[model samples]
Target: MVSISNSVKTGITTGTLRRVHHIALNVQDMQASRHFYGTILGLHELKGEEVPKTLIELVAAGKVANFVTPDGTVIDLFGEPELAPPDPDPKRGFTRANHLAFDIAPELFEQAVEVLRENQILIDHGPVTRPTGRGIYFYDPDGFMIEIRCDPMD
Candidate 1:
């Protein structure tokens, strides 16, 4: 494996990339997505600058809704009323392979599972053990796979 330091020395990357600022997802309903991420997931939304009235109007007309997680992760939900939701089956050609994983403490893993269960969110996979730690996979309202891991890669 190429070390980050070695990659930096070789100019593979600038080595200045700090962290991911946010992620965006397309959704069928902004309100439902908001409730899931904000209420069910317990991510605090950052109320920053006021969106322009015109933009707000557009969003109300089924454009989009942008939200930020408590850790500064921005989740953009695009309103696509007609598009079919993503497929959950990984073997399906149309299934989304990319996903987002949040790091959490080992002690909280069970609590997270309970929260997901209470919300009626289906678990896609295990609280399975990995080399790093335990992880569980589930789908969002949009059928986008999400992972909660007790350990993150160093």
Candidate 2:
């Protein structure tokens, strides 16, 4: 049997990376996509600026999409829709693996559902239980799957 040193045992810390800085996603239309994330999702528009001929960036801050429960996170919406992979099988429905997962406070589930329904957006699944806990799946205007989840352990 091999023995490990105390220093080696202490090296592995129980922690995660501080927080997600930003998630960049390609959208068919920058303006409409920004509206979906900012207006519909209730994320505040932090910045929406164009950078020359290359791309446009739309940043937002909010809770449902935040790094902290109420501290807000930065979501960078990119303008180059052509950059994302094309769905080879359009008839197969949304098969792209690219997505963003967000942590939603348990209390906000109802408001989230109402907001989504009011926006005429279709939900893929429910505020039901996973091993992780209750969650809901939905899509953005750009067909990017977004998940609102609550960790059971939390």
Candidate 3:
């Protein structure tokens, strides 16, 4: 055989990483989390397969959502049996590095909050106006704060 290393080098080519494939998260209740993400947030559901320990994938806006991002990355929602929300320290207030955010239509801010309140989800803050647009903060069943807003400021 002629120069195996040379042949390998010729075969290799440069490529660029596009974007994220998925995001894995441990949730308290798989069904509830699914409903919240799938129904409320409107993330499209895939096959709904259960693979024991492996993570589940909920495609954001499903296959047709490819046009949403330049790299065509889909958001994947995961469910873990042990992933419960941390206990809150009343004195410290609700604070943590873990959170998810979504941008809402500027005019629909109040409607969004009403929807959350109807679901009995706690409203942590206001859909009040900031310099950018209206924003509101709330917690999921797992105590993970979810921010819904329009025109978020840098």
Candidate 4:
């Protein structure tokens, strides 16, 4: 008879899974979104290209742009023409109900906040502290919420 260890039984293996590679977002204005993410957030633009014909026909997005964060996280922005932005859900209100969060160093958290303030970005919520970390929330150019958070030991 063969016996399997608990680690193997649970499918736990070292270095089997890597970090997130990218996140894609649909936007209304490619240039405005590009400036907010690439210029203001300090992410580097990799390249620009048209979205696949099938995707453009289906989703109405004609062009796409890619950017990378300092930590190698990728952000893909999609822009569609002639499509009106969806009306806000009454229950969720006007802004985004969900958000993307980025991890930051504790020391850099304050500097990040100052950078946003200097750019005239409004904070939607936080600078609040929790047991796990401190965080702040703000809205992107397209009304999507974003968070920057820091843990003391991280």
Candidate 5:
């Protein structure tokens, strides 16, 4: 058997890396992606000059779109021509669990669902139950799978 250690002797301490600081994604359109994540998803968009200093280089001097979740998770969307589009087949849907999951407050779950409906966004899988919580799945305009999980199911 093999064992791994991080007690400083093996190099990095447990605090070496904190929680996920950000997630970068490639998208089809800057404006649409910004609208979806900023407006529909209700994340705060970091408009010009408001983008974080540390992210400037990677953000490509206003070329990328930046949004922040209420919990401070940063989302960076890069608008580039697609190398390939999301699979259009049901059998390839799960595709080995390729998806991004976001958390929503249980109290606001119904409102969120309503918002999705109002926007005419299709719900691919849920509002389904699990021992852990209730979740809804869908796809972003670029075909990335997205999951919204509302815990403490009533």
Candidate 6:
């Protein structure tokens, strides 16, 4: 984990920044990513009218997309002409900026795991027990790892 300085955590700007607005990731193919995030994961997307005019062209060309999460945060995808290869060996808990995670209702964990298996999505880490609750990990089309888990309340 990257440690934030104590100053940053308690400083004037600490609470000024609200929740995450969005997170942008580079993808190999916009269409495949769309299917993974939208069709499979069932994330609702923002249409052309909601996005910037400049992004309209990229969206039509299947080079860009914006999907809204349950919490109202957005996941923006853009095609990368040249993508770097994944690191063969990564330190534990290090995602190198290509990982995402979200919590689901605890009772639904197993069903979500089943869905991933039925879709032939490879499970990279677990449907194992975490201190927070149950969790599962898998990779997206572009090799970006994603985690769906239960909230701490579970």
Q: Give every collision pair in model 5.
A: none
Over all chains combined, what TM-score does candidate 4 have? 0.70
Residue 89 miss distance in model 4 (angstroms)? 9.0
Q: How high is each candidate's TM-score?
A: 0.73, 0.62, 0.61, 0.70, 0.79, 0.80
**Number of clashes in every candidate structure?**
0, 0, 0, 0, 0, 0
| Candidate 2 structure quality by residue, lDDT tens digits, 23-119 | 6555667767767877777676553342222323213322112111245556656566464435643223554464577777777767887888889
Candidate 2, superposed: residue stretches over 4 Å from native: 1-17, 48-72, 81-85, 88-98, 151-154
Residue 111 lDDT (model 3):
81
5 or 6, greater by lDDT: 6
lDDT of 4 at 91: 24
Positional deviation of 47 in candidate 1, in angstroms? Answer: 3.6
Tell me the spans in candidate 6 whose CA falls farther than 4 Å from its real position: 1-12, 84-95, 152-154
lDDT of each: 0.72, 0.61, 0.58, 0.75, 0.78, 0.80
Candidate 5: lDDT of 79?
76
Candidate 3 stretches greater than 4 Å from native: 1-20, 48-73, 88-98, 152-154
> Model 1 off-target regions past 4 Å?
1-12, 48-62, 86-96, 152-154
The model with the greatest TM-score is 6
Over 57-117, each residue of candidate 6 has an lDDT whose tens digit, in order, gives 8888778898999899989998885765565333233345746897888887788898899
Answer with 1 or 4, whichever has the higher lDDT. Answer: 4
lDDT of 4 by residue, 67-116 (tens): 77778877888786553446543224354447888888999999999888
For candidate 1, write residues 57-134 as lDDT tens digits. Answer: 655565766666556666767777766645545424244356788878787888998999998986788879878899
Candidate 5 lDDT over 28-129, as tens digits, reads 777777888988898898865978887777567546889988888888898785535566553256344588888988988778888888998767887788
Ranking by TM-score: 6, 5, 1, 4, 2, 3
Q: State the displacement of the C-alpha of residue 93, model 1, in Å, after optimal TM-score superposition.
A: 6.1
